[model samples]
Target: MIDRDTVRHVARLSRLRLSDEEQETMREELSGILEHIEHIQSLDLDDVPITTHVVEVENVLGEDVPHEELSVEEALREAPEVAGGGFSVPRMG
Candidate 1:
């Protein structure tokens, strides 16, 4: 999400002086735009053969039969946050 500070920075670069209300509005709009772009970029289109139209793209995926390999306490059971044995998030300022 775009922050208020980012909105202010953009306004400054564009040589604009926005009111607080306008800044908040721009923040929401720009955040939405960026989020939409990110969602598009995250789509898995590897199976879609670069067509100009949209229809019949199939990859149905299901053929990797390798099982039984979760030993770290059954992969941290139902971890919401496991520390040293993997997966523990929240540290990005």
Candidate 2:
């Protein structure tokens, strides 16, 4: 269990200043957190396989084919502004 002194030490290392009430509260909260972690640590997991996610998933189907090449003129035909046969935009600062 974490005590007020330990909590104060932690707060000092973290560059925090806690009041007496806050220190007591943090000590209790941290003790509870440690107890919960200890409980989780006591669980048996020898037969359990490690996994990244809890649920299994499958890949979704995508488009069957890829895009074909387009002619330069066809590609630039819809451009709002063109200079030297290439798409152009305003200069930015």
Candidate 3:
């Protein structure tokens, strides 16, 4: 049973400023959500299988093929700066 105080506490924790009307609405909505969860919990699913997804999925990507490697000059052609036969990127802190 989600109450007004619980909603207000959650709002405070989330750093949200809810009006009185919004708080009341949130309380009702949260209570309804809890009720729905309780209803779902009451269902009998002893034979039901736990699954991560509802539909079966398979990798659709095609096989990888070997490709010719690019030369250092070709790779660094569009780079803003080049040093020591490679792209010179900005240093990170």
Each prediction's Cα lDDT score?
Answer: 0.88, 0.89, 0.89
- Model 3 lDDT on a 0 to 1 scale: 0.89
Candidate 2 residue lDDT tens string, 1-93: 997779989999998989999999899999998987897687899998889877788877978897777988998999999888899999974
Cα lDDT tens digits for candidate 1, 1-84: 889998999899998999999999999988888987897787899887766647777768977998877799988889898988
TM-score of each: 0.42, 0.43, 0.42
Best of the two (2, 3) by TM-score: 2
Q: What is the lDDT of residue 86 in candidate 1?
A: 85
- Which candidate achieves the best TM-score against the true structure? 2
Candidate 3 lDDT over residue span 5-63, tens digit each:
89999999998999999999999988988887887787899998988877889858966
Single out the weakest 10-residue window by summed lDDT for candidate 1.
Answer: 50-59
The C-alpha local distance difference test score for the whole of candidate 2 amounts to: 0.89
